[model samples]
Target: MPAARLPVYDAGPPCVSRAVDAFVRMGMAGVTFGAFMGSYDAVKEGYKGTGRALFVAKSAARNSLGWGMFGGAYMGLNCGLEALRRKRDWVNASAAGAITGAMVASTRSRSGIRVFGTAALFSSIATASEYLRPVQYPPTGL
Candidate 1:
């Protein structure tokens, strides 16, 4: 007599984990971009001595932090919403952007503009980006 074996399954990493990945990737990108821009501007200003590096570093640091927060929040909310609804679509992206925008707006000044300005702006940007993205189809055999 032979014993039957049960198959094991492997689920992917958690949403937050993926969100952290996004944060790092986006943050690094932001740091690089800010550094480049700052260096260019600083050089253009022709400020000799140690102040040049200081200005570049400041810009890079600021951008790194801001982008990291934006990426983490946006991806986290998007992933959470997708998991909750069990669907993959732009609605989740839009809602996530709006949520992220609201958070940013709240943290910054202008409480009144939180929902209307920032949230709406982000939601619109997300909607446009999602719409512009190429559609993905599943493999038939999978």
Candidate 2:
């Protein structure tokens, strides 16, 4: 009698898909924030014109692009590190996220304190999320 062979699954596509999903979600959030901020500022200034709407649109678009790039870099780093380590744990993900946050902050600000502060903040959030996430066990064949 011949032995049965199970199908082999590849993990690469799933990682890439997750990265793309992160990019889209982050980009949308940035767009929403930018739009809200731009409208609020416009309203506070008592501006009522097509120009104001245009400004809001531009702001949203710019924010979307910026956030997309940031998310791509962050996800890329996280996934790359996970692939290298062959482990999917919260600590590794948080470290990668923190490093990316610090790098982004350093580019925008000249203050080392600000960079490290942002990094610490991101790390804390990531760590907290890890703790809050529910754990699930694989199904056992009955």
Candidate 3:
């Protein structure tokens, strides 16, 4: 069956575009009333005034599921590719962190930025580590 013979495709490592796009979308979502209210509450508590804004920023980022997933996947794929190339994991982590920082800095709410940032960082680290140590599988004759 054709289905049985379907070939696995390896798309190249994801780039910053995907991560950036995801961050943009997430930032836009922060404009909603819910996000506004949440941001307001956070700011009112002096969370925004102090260096603790990042703590609240993470809370807001969780509202945008689509953006979060895209950013997460981008980091994951980037890490995976880097690992495959046997590069240091920090390289991928730094890239992901930068993307998250951009997303956070550009967005209105610190919560959104923080959450997405965390996702990006973790995804990048995890995927890169996984990719770096790959198990060899025997080839199957098709």
> Which one is best on lDDT?
1
Candidate 2, residues 1-142, lDDT tens digits: the string is 9544323243333456656867898899889988998898778878789978987898898888889877777777767776667665787669877998798898899899999999988777766765675442112232
- Lowest lDDT block of 10, candidate 3: 133-142
List the candidate 2 regions with Cα displacement exceeding 4 Å: 1-14, 133-142
Tens digits of per-residue lDDT for model 1 on 1-88?
Answer: 8544323222234777868987898899889988999899899998667999998998898989889989888878887886677666
Q: After superposition, how far is residue 37 of candidate 3 from its true place, in Å?
A: 11
Model 1 lDDT on a 0 to 1 scale: 0.80
Query: Taking the tens digit of each residue's C-alpha lDDT, what string does model 3 give over 25-111?
Result: 555664343366656777677674554455445555555554565455555555555546545455665565556545544454567
Q: Each candidate's TM vs. the true structure? A: 0.76, 0.78, 0.28
Give stretches of model 1 more than 4 Å off. Answer: 1-12, 41-46, 133-142
Clashing pairs in 2: none
After TM-score superposition, what is the CA distance of residue 140 in candidate 2 from its true location, in Å?
18
For every model shown, the clashing-pair count is 0, 0, 12
Model 3 stretches astray by more than 4 angstroms: 1-67, 70-77, 80-86, 109-142
